[model samples]
Target: MRADAKKNYDRLLAVAREVFNEQGVEASLRDVARRADVGLGTLYRHFPTREALLEVLLRASFDELTAKAKELETADAVDEALVSWLRETIAVAHSHRGVIGSMTAAIEDPDSALHASCLSMRASGERLLNRAQAKGLARNDIDGADLFALVGALAWLNDQPAHTSRIDHLFGVIASSILTNGVPVSV
Candidate 1:
């Protein structure tokens, strides 16, 4: 990439992050271009589509989440490691506000730009979940896909004003349900 084009790409990503943070993942691409002081044609030349742009914006965070899963895989407490990864996944999803829907849809669509990252992240969480289940610490009925869906659901709940105060309590309830002990946490 040329210097000027690379500069525009970087600025677009920075502005898109801010716009998406304020207006959710579905925020207008035109707004991102406008905020970045780039023309719509330039944004299109760089991103091609919203999903493509999101793929760039979220790729690093997804990679980090996968790395965290790897680190947690060897934790002394399998249950704690699984819960910790779940919390981290939810945080990542919630950070982009309305991205859960896109992620969930993308996971099922191989052609989607976000599919690879979503799949890697899901597989990472699945590994942790599988480890916990192997130790009889997590539910046997759930799989990696289920864990991914749960993350999406939890993130969506966080977007609701009515659920804001109860989000932590709800997370605890959901986490307890996944854990075999039946008594996970209150927050």
Candidate 2:
């Protein structure tokens, strides 16, 4: 891609991200084009469909999260590392609340790229969980699937308009339970 084309693509991605976060996957491509100061053809050239755009956005978020998890592995305290990663994950989910819903819908399509994205995220999260568990900080039985489910539930619950405080409280409860070496608590 040419420099100008790359610039246009970046602009479109930024605009699309904002629009999607505000209005969800159903947000208008035309509005995105307008926001990016580009034509519909240009937007389509960069993202063939709404699903394509969503896949790119979600993959980017997952990649960032995985990188953060890797960095957190070196923290002085294993429990602290795990708690910090969970908090970061919650923040990411809160930032991309609508994108999570769209990604889930896309993943449901048997051959969707979102399925591949999900697999990658699961593997990345598993590595982080395994590392923390190996340190004898996180609960032995707490697997990546458990963390994924916890994050998903928290993300869904946090998406509600009036649940910010509740989400934080829920996250705290989950962090304490999962980070505990003993049996997980019911929160």
Candidate 3:
């Protein structure tokens, strides 16, 4: 792709991601084009369908999370790395609420891009979880699947406008429970 074309494509994807997060999957492509200052044809050229655009945006987010996990793995403190990654994952889930909802609905469809991304995310998460467990910071019994499930539940619960503060409290409780050892308190 030409430099200008690539720039336009990237801008469109960025704008579309924000709009989709704010409005939903039903957000208009025309609006995305307008926001990106690109012609409608340019948007269609890069993303032929709404699903195609959504797939690109969702894949980008998953890729970012995967990269962050890899970086966290190399961090000095294993516990802090794992906690930071989990918190980042929660934030990503919260931001892409509608995308996640759509992905859940499409999980059973073999041809779904959402299904592919979901599998990729699981594999990426497994790598991080395994590393944390090996370091003896995270609980060995709680596998990647458990963490994934927890993230999904937390994401959905946190997406509700009225439950934001409650979700923060819930996350704190979860973190404390997962981090606590059986040792006696010093107090």
Candidate 3 lDDT, 44-74, residue by residue in tens: 9999888778888878788888888888778
Candidate 1 vs candidate 3, TM-score winner: 1
Which candidate leads in lDDT?
Answer: 1
Local distance difference test values of all predictions, in order: 0.94, 0.75, 0.75
Give the TM-score ranking, best first: 1, 2, 3
In order of appearance, the predictions have TM-scores of 0.98, 0.80, 0.73
Instruction: Report model 2's TM-score to 2 decimal places.
Output: 0.80
Clashing pairs in 3: none
Q: How close is candidate 3 to the true structure, as a TM-score?
A: 0.73
Give each prediction's root-mean-square deviation over alpha carbons. 0.8, 3.3, 4.1
Name the weakest run of 10 consecutive residues (lDDT summed) in model 2. Answer: 178-187
